[model samples]
Every structure is written in structure tokens, then in C-alpha cells.
Target: MIQRLLFAGLLSGLVVALFAFSFARVYAEPTIERAISLEEGGAHKHAAVEKGTISRSTQRNAGLFTGVAAYCTALGGFLAIGMAFLHGRLSVRPRSAVWTLALTGYVALVLVPQLKYPASPPGVGSAETIGVRTELYFVMILASAVCMAASVWIAFRIRRRMGMALSLAIATGLLVALAAVLMTIMPAVSETPRDFPRGLLFEFRLHAALMQLIVWGGLGFLFGRVAEHVVEHDRPAGVVRHRIPNA
Candidate 1:
């Protein structure tokens, strides 16, 4: 039983880690380019970056690392609570799909642009990128939200837990959002307010990270539980399940 639990924990952590690396790479790819500039042709194979640029990268990397880090951190959390898989009531393909859509859109459409330029073009970069770009991103955000709602609803139907899955997932999201909003908006009491523009940018990334953490953590916990229950109850106890399609 210990071995099984460890295996499950490791697998879940891997899921979270891979998603984190992939998602961060997607969003930070372009920005990483300019942050670490090509060096003068002094024969250094690697490029050099300014102290300011490196500082910026460090901040971005911290947020990106934390976004996926939640998954790994949640391991002992879910396990100790015995609902790491949300009692298996939250696990389902639909649930996973919803998370996938949201994460992908966030990394690709919402977060990536900020790496190269700014999320709100009017606010950060040149005026040339302001108009339709914002609208397109808003549309993508809406689509992602819709997918989350519909998928969680469907996952609820698959479990016999009387809508527990939906409630928990939604609750997790709301709690995270509330905390993030406050963190992003509340004015710091520090007297040094003028020096925080760059800090604000990285802090805002937490908004994106918070969402991913809630959704993916919930999915991993829920999926693990449901998968176990299905195998034990739906299939013959002694028979191993196969993934290939049947005739």
C-alpha cells in the first residue's frame, strides 16, 4: 500500500512538473530571447545579459516555477487528506480536458505575449499592437472559462458523489482567485512605492499561476481517485484493464 501511494504521488508530481515546464516555456519563450541577448563576437558560445535583464528573468522564473510547483507541493496535501484524488469522485476525462484547454490557452494566448511584449499592448509596449489584440485575448479567456464550467459539470455527472466534485473544484478556484486579487490590488504599506512597476508585473503573473494551480491540482486529485474507483468497481477485480478499443 505504501509503495502504491508513493507511485501515485510521484506520477502526480511528474504530471504537474511537466505541465509547468511546458507552460512556462510556452509563455516565456520569446521574452527569454531578449532578456538573454546575443553576446559580442568575442568567441563566447553563450550570450551575455545585463544585470537588469537577469533580475527580470529571475522574477519571471520564480512565478513560472511556482505555477507548476503547486502540483508537486500538493502531493502530501492530497495524500494526507485521503481526498488527494478527491475521493475519486472528481476524476474524469472531461475534467482533465477542461484543465488542458485552460492551461494551454493561458500559456499560449494570455501569458506568452507578455514575455515578448506586454499583455496589454497599450500599457507596456508600442502603440502598434493595441487594438484587435486585446479583443482576441478576451475572447480566448471567455472560451477557457466556459470550457472549465462545462467540463466540471460533466465530471459531476460521472461520479456518484452527489455533485461533490463540482462544488470542490469551483470552491478551490474561487478561494484562489480571491486571494490573488487581493494580493495583486492591495497597496503595500511600504514607503517605497515608486520602485515597484517591475515588481507589479511579476506579481501579476501569480494571477495566471493561481488559476492553473487550482485547476490542475484539483484535476490530479480528482482524476486519481476516480481512476482507482472505476478500476475496482467497474471491472472484474482480478482482471487487468486494457486501453485498446474493442470490436
Candidate 2:
């Protein structure tokens, strides 16, 4: 199970690579010359200049290394803990405990830095335009939350795993839903932040919400297997007490 999860994490890293490549817009040069040739005056030249700036921002971030590195790093961390647990060096309880922390910490670590900049602000780019948008990163952030929630379920399946299971589920469910809704609204609101509505439904993004369900289902099967193994190890030792014999 540890090996398989590790492999899954590695595979996920590869998937990140595909997204990275797809986002590569480094050399997408605009017909700046063509536009200038046709219209030497009017608002067309100024608009072209503004577009050039957005395009340049797109080029600077079109690399694939960053995405794959982040995915592999998280997966590797989870797999390392799983290995220690498998080898008995790490107690099942500790393994179970850290899984929760690892997921939450990883999500924050990946996301917080993405939001630390000014240009990376929300709703500021087109779908084809590349850069770490807050909404998009939030979508990916659900991956770890979902993983940890399953780990909680694994803990629940054991003698005392129930509490953690329910707690993690509720937490993960909420995050997933929030992430999904943000994906939908971020794109729209980003396009027109000035006109975005501030109502009751403003809490969540559409893409992030729907993704939570998927995250839960996949993690459910994974953590179940981990729980089974952990429980087997934690089983009480057999007794060999001698019975009193009748005279």
C-alpha cells in the first residue's frame, strides 16, 4: 500500500507536468507590428501596448519545473511517512496523526506563497493566459485536504479511528466545496471584479465545490487500505495463560 500510494503520488507529479507544458506561453508573440501597420493612430495603439504587458507576464511563468516539483515533493513526503509506518519505526498512531498535519501544512505552504505577490491578484487573466491564479491553485490545494481526510477515515476504521474520521470528513468536505465554488466564481468575478455581487452565494467557487466529492471518494479507498494494515499491526498479542486443572 505504501509503495502504491507513493507511486500514485509520483504519477500525480507527472500529471502536473502535463499541465505545466500546456500552460507554456513563453514565445506566443503578438502581431504588434501588424496592428501598428494597419492603425498608426486611435486607441488601438494604446490597447496593443497594454496587451503586450499582459503577454510579457504570461511568458515569464510558462515553465513546467515548478508544478512537477511541488507535486512530487508532497507525494514523496506522504510516502516517506507511510514507509516509516510500514517498517514499524513509526507508530500507526503517529503515522495517522502526521498525515493530517502533512496535508494541511502542504496546502498552506504551496498556496500562501502564490498569494504573496501583487501582480498575481485574482481575476486578472484570460483562460489561455498562464500564471498561478489564486482560484486555480485553490483547486489543486484540495488534493492534500482530500488525502488527509481519507487518512482520518483510516484512523476511524481501527479501534479508535471513528472520531478522527468524522472530523476530517466534515473539514475536508467543507474545503473541497469552498475550493470548487471559488473556481467558478473566480473566473467570472476576475473578469469583472468591479461588478461582482456580494451575496450569500459568494462564499464558494463552483469548480472547487464539485471537486471535493471526487477527492473524498478517491481518498476513501486509499485510507481504508492503510487503516486495515495499521489495525492488523495494532492487534492485541495472543495470551498463553495456563488454565487451572481439576483434581
Q: Highest TM-score, which number?
A: 1
CA-only RMSD, every prediction: 13.1, 12.4
lDDT of 1 by residue, 164-220 (tens): 556557644653454344334432222212322454445445544554565455445
Report the poorest 10 consecutive residues by lDDT, candidate 2: 25-34
lDDT of each: 0.44, 0.40
Best by lDDT: 1
Name the lDDT value of residue 230 in candidate 2.
50
The lowest-lDDT stretch of 10 consecutive residues in candidate 1 is 187-196
